[model samples]
Target: MPAAANLAVMDIPTPQEALRKLLLERLRPLVETPGRAQKPCGMQFRGTQLFSYCCFTTERIAAFETLQAVIGIVLNGTKEFWVGNSGRRFSAGQVFVLPAGTKLDVVNIPDDRRGRYEALIVEVHHLPPALAALPELPQPAARETRHDVTLTAELVDALSHAAHTLASSDHAEILAEHRLAEVLMLLRNDPAARCLFDLSLRERIARMVVAETTRTWTAEAIAAKLGMGASTLRRHLTQDGTALREVLATARMQIARGMLERGEANVSTAAEAAGYASRSHFIRRYRSIYGAVPSEHLAR
Candidate 1:
């Protein structure tokens, strides 16, 4: 067997597990150089050569520089990233690719005063020239464009699954290379995929805010947590056509409704769980948005 093939089937059981374990092992030798953050579940490993992490934390400032390419998926939460001379923001259900030699920084902002945010990060050595040589992607002129390419959920799920599979070792380098190629092909067809090859700053803030009517948060507190001046944050979001408060309310109501439908919690419980301080307040918002009372909606 080829050396990589031999390494592939060695002692691993499932393909997914083997790939992840092997990556962890390989990364073990490189932890000292560039440094690594704590790994979240589903992230196989971190090493000097390659690293991945998933984070859901209160708003804070973070910065890093890499000599390698980085691809990130924002599964749930908003991230504003600064790359070299450009900056871009991404929200839940979005994906971003950063080229090698890019200086990157991210800050998470919560529409509600809750200060909760999350994202996934994946970094690999520079894309091979062969990969970069694929046909150029067309995008709106940077001067007129405001949003980065939005990746479909299907593509995101596929990439996530592939990354999980790669964490296992059942495949040889050829197989691994093929899987990576598949991901590149998907990006090639996506309008937003060009950003992966050429590094640029893209900014995206949430179009909607989600807040619990019952929970009260001071503007100063919210502004400080997001690392933005209160006035500035409000102005930007307002210009987007929705007030921050409206976004927060919509988000919380959606969560409440989902919980109620799942039968995981009753009206009162679901309301509070969704960040309402009082059942009455929750019910009021719920009725206003859904045209039915929380209990009535749950009954169905």
Candidate 2:
């Protein structure tokens, strides 16, 4: 069959249909039985192949768990996923891994009411027999950690180009296999990489503080909420190579920068929304940390 001119631009009405289309397009050659129907609003990527698609809705428990072993990238929107039987939440930016056979539930909360839950889901089943023969796949960490990693525009562009290339060329499958391995390696090597699937209560609370960048948070307050002592909280953050305040500041700045880039807020508004009491303070701090003023940074 001939490929659609704008195959990547189609607005699949439902998540199930979208997954179905994606499988038919990307994984038809790998699976023995490729014509099976997916559960309502969901699709399966069978066998050993790489498949990618954008999801546009809040996914429930059953729906989310369907892609249990897949690794996904968050182009936009927040996804709250769980690992194992733990009751904790994990939210990340840009790229993150969803452990194999891990039950994940995602909620897409956009700043704007009209915002849709958009993500690029990539599934790779083609591992060399030798690589696949490892005793066990990388399992989720026992404790969850929060990371602040830089996702440069160059990296995003590279991923987009790779995805486009995979969708268009006959060598798409081969290219995807290589690219997915590269991405996984990059993430595995990152010092800040955290396990999204196995977060603890304390870690979840800490993540919540980070996610709500607008709130003016204090160690004592956060500790109180988590039912931990300020000293204990410091100990936990110390293990992560930075203090609680630094992490909080970084999180706020990251959110502010994203909001400014998206034109969701202007300089002062972004600063204030990120919990800065004064515009001057925000600008000075932003410049010191990011090496550029808010306006200059946003202009790029």
Candidate 3:
């Protein structure tokens, strides 16, 4: 072959290819020998927003709601999402951003040829100071909206670097937050990215509850912290077709679910972290919301 043909044939991997390779190399060991770590489904950086998701079987987890906005990159399988009546499928190397408080059904299907699925997920909760300084931020609709993003090379590299940093460094929270901010900036122009700037009342309350799950949160206390009257807050939430109890329950369940997924805590520990003084109460509530007890869930 000519020199030019040889150079073209030996070209370096693209950003998408690089990301796929990076995730597979790092997460393959964890998936193969799950007992080596506490993780059963995937690995999570406790203090950071980064996490890995792996699945060998096709299971549809229905009505999975996002307590916080998240961005996910599919590395080794097809992730199918059903939001309301609409359905969409994202394949390997694709990215999707879901707004906070959105409810959807999701299924993880391993790659037909590879026989395994892996992905990287990052929760976007911290709004950068500069972005929050904007005077007029766009408000998303009360209903859920999905942002199917076309990742640029810069974005792909940012995600790859974040995964590497979190996986290798013991003290990576500050750096991880900075990297998360970079991700938000990259997708700033996209409509879905506005969730970080302009949050709805329900989502705002959810974020607060999730931040301090152990707190004995009451409507009056939450209202006082938000600088609003208790009655007024209740009125607004009522208008939104929810109440303080519902919000608190959902937020607590989200924390408990996260703890269980990480596999670092037992059911009792998760229950306490979720502010449930009674383990029985926590199990009943979890079953009502997630359709299974935490123990049964862990078995999966």
Candidate 4:
């Protein structure tokens, strides 16, 4: 070979060849899955409890609280994430069940073969309206362990179909709502999925109120879902050392705080979503609970 050709071959480093190929291949699964036409890079979800979808993000999120009860699925890479007090390592194709207003400490979003931290997050604001008869919930025989580590395959499939048929943004929004509701319905009803849910009456009702923050919630309606009368429900909550109004207020503020942290909603938007008739009242209460005004979260 000529001297120049020898130099050219030397200049091509072999060590990084695998990484280069891996980087290039990252663009392959742009859609949620195979046999579909999507660039995975730009897919977005909009809907009911599962609020929105995001492509991979490099943004570092530390000890930030989740806006509402949320369902997060990691499509690629590993995530060191926590919901409430449970801390565990989550791998790809795993699901996360974060409690409403749970402070999430995301240790990090790993950069790996799957590219940046790629996952889907849906904020749950509303659960299905109560059925006339709830299934007979099993009493706790021992300590009930919360489970966030569940298979993400079914969830990934449902979300994939939802995104594949996304027409308009408006349509996308509607699609998310029904599909998420469907998923929640399935989780609530599936005997096998019982461990993945938080079954405490207060916690369950609190999640429901947070999911439907904009609507006026009544104790009677919540009581119906739990298969009890309003007075009995109140008595139960009282025994649990909480009240219906307290749960609503806490859920609202936590939801607003999460929105503020992500810069997704303005102070006013958050207030409205949290069901405050007056922005001033929202601001005062937000500061009292979260230790800052809503807008301050963005600045922080």
Question: Which candidate leads the pack in TM-score?
Answer: 3
How do the residues 1-300 of candidate 3 rate in per-residue lDDT, one tens digit apiece? 667776545678987667656655644443244445433455444336666787777879888777567888777788998977788888787778877777889988988887767777777764655554456654555754555675666776676666656555575765776676677778776664555656767777777777666678888988876768999999999999999888887887788787777675789988988778999999998998778898875523
Which residue runs does candidate 3 get wrong by more than 4 Å? 1-47, 56-68, 112-115, 126-130, 139-146, 192-198, 212-246
Candidate 1 on 84-187: residue-level lDDT in tens? 66778876545577654445676766434423454445544333346645554555555334445444444545565546545555552335455556676677
| Reference-based lDDT, residue 237, model 2 | 75
Q: Per-residue alpha-carbon lDDT of model 4 for 183-291, expressed as tens digits?
A: 6655664443453354577677767775555667899988876678999989999999999888877877777776776567888989987879899999998888878
Return the TM-score for each candidate structure: 0.41, 0.37, 0.68, 0.64
Regarding TM-score, does 1 or 3 come out ahead?
A: 3
lDDT of each: 0.52, 0.51, 0.72, 0.60
Query: Residue 34 in model 1: shift from native, Å?
Result: 29
**Every model: Cα RMSD to truth:** 18.8, 19.5, 5.5, 9.7
In model 3, what is the error at residue 246, expressed in angstroms?
Answer: 5.1
Report the poorest 10 consecutive residues by lDDT, candidate 2. 38-47
Task: Write the residue-wise lDDT of candidate 2 on 201-237 in tens digits.
Answer: 3344445554445566888877776567989988987
Error of 4 at 169 (Å): 4.3
Which scores greater on lDDT, model 1 or model 4?
A: 4
Candidate with top lDDT is 3
Residue 231 lDDT in model 2?
94
